[model samples]
Target: MTSMSKSKTNNGNGTVDSRRQEVQRIVKNACDQLNSEGVDARNYVEQLAWLFFLKAFDEAETRREEEAAFDDAGYERRLSGNFAWSSWASKTDHPDEMLEFVDGKLWIKLTSPDPKKGLGDDPLAERFRR
Candidate 1:
């Protein structure tokens, strides 16, 4: 019998940390909810889109408020404002750049066409389409 060689696997320790664990927990909960409703987790594109929109909206609003305060302070320093929602889109005219900024797995779930055997026919999708 030939000996089997084990390939070295990187766990991406550089990217995995406490913060990543928290995010994973949140995603797992959402998936679990979908599973309980007899809905395929992969068909959660609509939910993902809504969440993304809310998150981006909150971030953009917070950044705008912070930036305005800085401007009022007469601080002519460039603030690394949080790029989310239309603020992120406005940052770059290039489609690629716009995509790059929101290229996380959550964003992919929202924008990808018929991802994972295509989105199921559901009211959530209908609402999202609007």
Candidate 2:
């Protein structure tokens, strides 16, 4: 990661390269935690990537809320309530909870229709469904 550039993000909290490294580090930690539970390294990384995608989507929604440019702002917030990364991803205290949410419930939602959310034919939603 040190070999990567250190250009700062718009937030100025950290460099773009550093932020990617941080995500990778988090994914590694997640992989380590799940490996003991019989999850394969490759699959764990995939799971982490999916979760990160959700986090990014949720962040975009939050950004829209903070900077409301239109009535349709934050409309891309597909995941809400428990399914959102803010709820599941933020649960770092109990490692088992994170693992259970990602490994169990996450898969079911990803493949099935979320009755609570009526985001029909949404591109992101459709991708998750498949």
Candidate 3:
């Protein structure tokens, strides 16, 4: 059987890097576990990409709020409800509900053609549109 190779990185100053190892270990574990349950490896990776995109966008929205970049009231009103990652991803009361949401409303918003409304020209949303 093949062994998982340890990940390496350099600080550009020639040193053993542990950061890469941690991320590699995390991803390897997730993929291994998911694949064992008959999940296609590629699909698992794609779903992970979606999650990372949402988390990153949520963070960016928070930054924009702090900077007063968007219409404050409007921004809060837009995301503070079911539209926010926290609500659909973490705070959902049931697993099935979250699944329905991820495949439904979330998908719709990311792919919304009305650029002036949902996600509105956001590059990350475009990445998740598929």
Stretches off by above 4 angstroms in model 2 are 1-18, 28-40, 69-76, 114-120
Question: What lDDT does each candidate get?
Answer: 0.55, 0.69, 0.67
Quick one: best lDDT, which candidate? 2
* Model 3 residue pairs with clashes: none
Ranking by lDDT: 2, 3, 1
lDDT of 1 by residue, 1-130 (tens): 2232122123345354555677779888978877899998668866576655656555666677778797884322111244335455465568687556566533443343443345564332444355
Report the number of the highest-TM-score candidate. Answer: 3
Which scores higher on lDDT, 1 or 3? 3
* Every model's TM-score: 0.39, 0.59, 0.60
RMSD per model, one decimal: 15.8, 5.0, 6.9
Q: What order do candidates take by TM-score, descending?
A: 3, 2, 1
lDDT of 1 at 93: 61
Residue 49, model 2: Cα distance from true site in angstroms: 1.7
lDDT of 3 at 46: 72
Q: Tens digits of per-residue lDDT for model 2 on 1-130?
A: 2323333333465566677888789767867778889988766566666766777888887777667656654454456678777788777899898888877987677666555655574455578766
Please report how far candidate 3 places residue 20 from its true position, in Å: 8.9
